[model samples]
Target chain A: MDAAARLFSERGYHGTSMQHLGQALGLQRGSLYAHIGSKEELLFDVVNQGAERFLGMARHAASSGEPAAARLRALLVGHVSTAAQHLEASTVFLNEWRYLSPVPRAQIQAKRDLYETVVRRIISDGVAAGEFDPGVNVAMAGRLVLSAGNWIYTWYHPDGALSASAIGAELFDLILNGLAKEGPA
Target chain B: MDAAARLFSERGYHGTSMQHLGQALGLQRGSLYAHIGSKEELLFDVVNQGAERFLGMARHAASSGEPAAARLRALLVGHVSTAAQHLEASTVFLNEWRYLSPVPRAQIQAKRDLYETVVRRIISDGVAAGEFDPGVNVAMAGRLVLSAGNWIYTWYHPDGALSASAIGAELFDLILNGLAKEGPA
Candidate 1:
């Protein structure tokens, strides 16, 4: 899965082929079928699994018994940390999912929509509970938080100056305080 | 340029060829070179011009005599508005620059670095003037702002619920208040 994700990220889904996968994995062309059925299936698996990881983290965080702000914080941490830890898969998930065939594409998008809804609900809840400003645009704010975390995969190197956790902490502070009411809740 | 950018965004850079551009433009293969050099030149033009538009907007806003918060607001408005107005070119600039040759790639990167530095300095200045929290990580905050604004192209639609300026105002409000010092500047 990691190898497939890395290749897909580097060369793109259409540019990579089963032969390249075989070369990378040291498998005979005929023997490769035993592990993976077809190139599309591999692409499906890589994309589906990648989406599942993100959606799973978001689902778990959204359902946690924490306050809306805490839930949002947890979601941010999960989002940035997962993207950093699974940088290749996150890249494939972000850019290469468009290559999936219709059925798998729909499935992945449904999962993505669910994850987005989870984020939206948290922000809306925050707004309702007065944890966030009442005038906040729930949908736009949700997308902003997700984009801010998602783009980290584009530039956050594991060995770079800041670890994923450090970045997450800074983002959490920035976001929560940003969303806070001017005076007090 | 729009056709080329849409094609590049739809098809990976390597997957797109001179023939694809000619077909998209309804030009004969031989006549294509009369208007554009090679496919690479087209890619460079698309990416560089898109980047230039962004950097120009940022530079203009950065050099304005506004306070840090107002300058940041101008930058966000410019960033999101430009991306929304030039969706196809923005898409290619965000994703297809890796396909450029080393020289063009470096030129683009240099411009990107300049943009990044401009944002960082604004945040750092805000911190120094006691407008934003002193402990804010200037570099990370800068990337967060860019990522949040840059990702606007992904979900922003011309006919969507909000206009580009509405979204920009909301983002500006979120970011400025989020970075504000505890009591007063």
Candidate 2:
């Protein structure tokens, strides 16, 4: 999967083939087919797995008993950590999913929208709870958070000055303070 | 340039060719070359023009006599508006620059880095002026702001609920309030 993710990330989904995947894996093309259903299926698996990791974390965070602020913080941490851990898959998920066939593409989009909904709910809750600026655009705030988390795949490096945890914490601090800025603690 | 940008955005840079671009513009392959030097040159032009717009705004904001917070707000508005106005060009700039030959790629990378440095300077200034949390990571905070602005190209729609100005304003409000949350106005 990692090898496939790297290839897809580097060469793009349309540019990659079953034969290429087979070559990377050092398996015969015929043997590769026996093991993996098809190239599209492999793409679906990679994209679906990446989406699931994110959605699962979002669900857990949203379902938590904590306050909206803490819940949002947890969501950021989960998002950053997951992307950092699966950087290549996350890159493929972000960049290559556009090439997925109609059915799988819609499925992935739905899953993505679901994750976004959870983020929106957290912001809305914060606004309602008087923990965030009432004037805050809930949709925009949600997108901002997702953008911040999603884009880490582009720049987050393992050997960089900050660990993934530290990066997540910094993002949380920036966002939490921003949303809660005009509100009373 | 617009034609090239749309083509590149829809098709991966590698997947696109002079024939594809020429067809999109209703030009013969030979005629296209007569008008435009080469596909790489077009890519560089598209990417360079986009970067220049972004960097121009960042430089202006950075050099302004306004307070760091206000300058940052202006920068967001500029970044978001430019991105919304030229979504395809911005998308190509962000996603397709990777396919540039090494020399042009480095040139683009340098411009991008320069834009980032301006953003970082703004954050550092805000911190120094006690207008933002002193503990803020300048580099990370800058990236957060850029991510929020850069990713606008991905989801921004001209006929969406918000106008480009409104969207920019919302982003500014989010970043401003977030960064200045702990600071006294």
Candidate 3:
């Protein structure tokens, strides 16, 4: 699965073939059939693997007994770290996820929605607790947070100067602190 | 150019052929050569077109002589609104931009860097003027703003009940105001 992800991310899905996957692992084409049915299956495997990591992070954060802000930080940081650590899988999920079959796509989307719902819940709690501003729209805020986290796939390299944790902490500060020179930014 | 963008974004670069493009516009494959010389030209044409829009927006904002915040708003709102309006071209810019040849790729990249540099200068000036937080990281913040604006290609739908300007305004407020439920969030 790791090899599959690495290959798929480095070379696009269209650029990869069953034969290439076989060659990378010193296995013949026929042997690969024992492990996977087809090309789409490999793509699905990589997507599923990446989705699970993100889902687990969200679930853990939601279940944790932290305050809303803390939970949000955990979720955001977990997402950034996941993207950094599993760059290939993360890239595949962020970029090639549209290639899944309808059923698999629905399943993957449900997981994604589940993650968003968790973020929304935290935002809701934040608003209710007056920890967040009343004007913060949950759906839009959820999308924004998800965008900020997921878009890390485009630039967050493990080999990059800033570590994932450092980026996460800084983002946490920015989100919690805002950017405005005046009031909370 | 718009027709090519629609075909390429709806399908993909490698997934699109000159004949497919020809078919989309009801033209014979051989005749397409009269206007478009080759497959690579379509990719470059569409990318170059989108880059021009983005660079135009950035140029306008940088020259507006407004305060940093107002100019930043113009930069953000202009890019996002234009992206939403030209859905197909925006998608090509976001997703299929990698298909350009080395020389043209460098050109596209240069335009992209210029756009980023424009926004970075705004943030830097704002920070220096004490209108933005002194702690602001101009480059990272500019990229974050760009990423947030670009991901609209992945999820936004024109008929989905939200207007482009409204979405841009909401996003601008969120990024400008931030998510923190704290002293300044």
Candidate 4:
């Protein structure tokens, strides 16, 4: 699975062939087919695993019973950590999932939408509790958070200066406090 | 070029073939070869065009003689608008540029680095002028800005509720002001 994820990330889903998978695994075509159904199956498995990881983190954070801000922080941290730890899978998940056929594609899309909804709900809760600015655009705020979190897969390295959690925390701080010295004005 | 960009974006650089490009353009292989050298050339052309659009926008913003915040806003808006307007090319540029051969790859990387530097300089200037929070992590903040801007190509549509500029402006407001009601806590 890891090898498959790596190839998919490097060569793209359509570009990676079953023959290539066999070579990567050091298996003959017959042996490879004995274990896996098709290239699409591998693609689906890799993409599905990634969706689950993201959705799992979001779900855990949503149910953590923490305040909205804390919950959001946890969610972002978990998300970045997952992407950093599973870099190849995350890359394939983020970039190649669109190639999934209709049924599986819809399944992944549902999970993705659910994840966004969870993030938005956290922001909405923050707004309702007066913890976040009442004037906040919940949807846009949610997109910004997800965007920052999602793009980490492109640049993050485990051996880099910052850990995944630290990256998430810094982003969380920026999202909550902003860049302006006076905050807004 | 448009057909090539669309194919490259949809099928990926490695997955797309000369035959596919020829078919998309309603040209025979001979005619396709008459107009283009190879798949790599098309890839480089598309990626380079996208890079120029992005760098052009950032350079324009950087040289605007405006305050850091205003410059940053113009940069973000221009970045988002470019991505939204050239969705197919932007998608290929962001996702498939890595498939370029080493020399062209380095050229793209250089432009990308310059773009990041431009963004970071805006934030650094803001901090130096006391317009932004002195505690801001300029690198992370720049990544956050670029991440938000880059990810728009995945979801933006010409017929969407908000125009590209409006979406960029809303994100600019969020990035500058934050979500916390009382700011930074």
Candidate 5:
């Protein structure tokens, strides 16, 4: 699975072939076929695994029983950490999932939408509790937060100056406090 | 060019072939060769055009002479608008540019890095001018802003509820005011 993730991440799903997967796994075509039903199955498994990881973290954050602000921070931090720890799978999940057939793709999409809903609900809770700005657009706020979190896989390096948690903390601060000096003009 | 953009965006650079390009353009392979050198050339052209569009908007925003807050808003708006307007090209540019051979890939990378630098410089100037919070991490702030901006191409629809400019304004406001009502914890 790690080898599959690596190949899918390095070369897109369409670009990676069963032959490539077999080579990466050091298995003959016969053996590879015995292990996995098909290339799409492997792709589905990899993408599904990634979706589960993200959804698992998000669910944990959502049910943490913290205030909205704290929950949001935890959510963002967990998102960044998950992507950093599983960079290859994250890349495949973000970039190559579209290659899945309609049924599996819909399954992944549902999970993704649910994850977004989790983020949105946090912001909605924040607004309702007076913990967030009254005028905040919950939907857009959720998208922006996910956008920042989802994009980390594209550029994050394990050896980079900032750890995943530090990067997530900084992003959370920016999202929570903003860049404006005196608030909105 | 439109056909190439659409095909590249749909099938990805590696997944696309000269044959597909010729078929899309209703030209024979021989005739297609008369007009272009190779499939890579078309990919490079499409990706390069997308990079140039993004850079053009970012440069315009960077040089707008507005205060940091306003300039940042303009930058985000322009980024969203460009991606929304050139959806297929933007898709290819963002996702398939990595498939370019080393030289062309480096060219696109430089432009992307330069665009990120433009974003960073805007935040830095804003901080120095007292329009933005002094404690901001300029780099991470820039990434957050760009992340929200760049990810738009993935889901933006022309007929969506909000126009590109409207979405950009909302995102800009979120980045400026944040979701927290009482500011950072």
Candidate 6:
């Protein structure tokens, strides 16, 4: 899966073939079929892997029993961590999503939307509970959160100065508090 | 420019050729080259043109006589509006940026960094002025704001129910005040 994902991401899904995967795994193109049913299956598996990881993280974070504000932070942090942890698979989930068959693609999109729905609900609850700004727009807020979390695959490097955790922490503060100057809490 | 930009963005950079641009414009490839140097030049020109628009908008917004919050609002709103006004060019800027030559790429990147740096400074000032959360991480705050702003291109539709102004306003509140319920202002 790793070899397939790396090649597919670098070369693009259409450009990758079974022979390439076989070479990466020290097998002939025909031999790969024994282990993996089809190219689309490989893509489906990789994408689902990442999607499951995200949904799992969201579920775990939701059950953490934190305040709504803290829960939202946990979701953001967990998401970036998952993206970093499964960089290859997550990259496929994010970038190669178009190559999936409609059934699988819609399934993945639904899960992605579900995660955002949870985030939106959290923000809405936070607002009602006075843990968030009253003016929060749930739709834009969810998309904004998803955007920051999703784009890390484009720029983050393992050896960069900021660890994923640190970056997530910084992002959490920025999103939760904003950059406005204010008196000390 | 819009026609060229649309082609460059919809088709991959290398996938787009002078011949195709000519076909779009109803000219021979040779005639297209007379007006344009090469495919790379076209890309660079489109990217530079879009960057200039964004840079102009940001500079104008930041340097305006409005209050800090209002200026930031205008900056964010103007960007979304400009991107919508020049959707094809903006999409090309976000997606096909890599095809630019070294010098042009660096220039655009520098301008991009400057825009981000300016936003960070504004956020820092806003935090300092007690109009925002003091604990905000200005750099990451800038990234969230910018990324959230740019992602509008991915999903926003001209005929969509939500206007650009509404998105900007909602996003500004999300980034500045957060989802936390407002205490007394």
| Top model number, DockQ | 4
Q: Number of the top candidate by lDDT?
A: 4
Arranged by lDDT with the best first, the candidates are 4, 5, 2, 3, 1, 6
lDDT of 5 by residue, A1-185 (tens): 89999999998888888889888888888899999999899999999999999999999999989999999999999999999999999999998998898999999999999999999999999999999999999999999999999999878999999999999988998998888887645
Model 4, span B9-105: residue lDDT tens: 8878877889999898899999999998888998999999999999998999999999999999999999999999999999999999988889999
Which DockQ-derived CAPRI band holds candidate 5?
A: medium
Q: Measured against the native two-chain assembly using Cα atoms, what DockQ does each of the candidate structures obtain, in the order listed?
A: 0.42, 0.44, 0.59, 0.85, 0.77, 0.43
lDDT of 1 by residue, B1-185 (tens): 88899888887676687889899989988999999888889989999999899989998999898778778889988899999998888988988787687898999999999999999988787777766777677887788788888888668889988889788877877766652234121
Task: Assess the local accuracy of residue B8 in candidate 5 as a C-alpha lDDT between 0 and 100.
Answer: 83
- Sequence-dependent TM-score of model 5: 0.98
- The superposed Cα distance between candidate 2 and the true structure at residue A162, in angstroms, equals 1.2
**What TM-score against the true fold does each predicted structure earn?**
0.92, 0.92, 0.94, 0.99, 0.98, 0.84
What TM-score quantifies how close candidate 4 is to the native fold? Answer: 0.99
In model 4, residue pairs whose N, Cα or C atoms come closer than 3 Å (at least 3 residues apart or on different chains), thus clashing, are none
The model with the greater lDDT, 4 or 5, is: 4
Once superposed on the true structure, which residue ranges of model 1 sit more than 4 Å away at CA? A28-30, A179-185, B179-185
Query: What is candidate 1's DockQ?
Result: 0.42
Model 3 DockQ reads 0.59
List, residue by residue over A22-127, the lDDT tens digit for candidate 3: 9999999999998888988889989998989999988998889888889988888888898998888998898777868799989999988888899999989988
**Ranking 1 against 5 by lDDT, winner:** 5
TM-score of chain B of each: 0.92, 0.92, 0.95, 0.97, 0.97, 0.93
Q: How far off is residue A181 in model 4, in Å?
A: 0.4
Docking class of 4: high
Docking class of 3: medium
Model 3 regions more than 4 Å off: A26-28
Give a tens-digit lDDT track for model 4, residues A1-185. 89899999988887798899999989998999999998888999999999999998889999888899999999999999999999999999999999988999999999999999999999999999989999999999999999999999889988899999999999999999999998756
Docking class of 6: acceptable
Stretches of candidate 4 exceeding 4 Å from the true structure: none
Which candidate would rank higher by DockQ, 1 or 5? 5
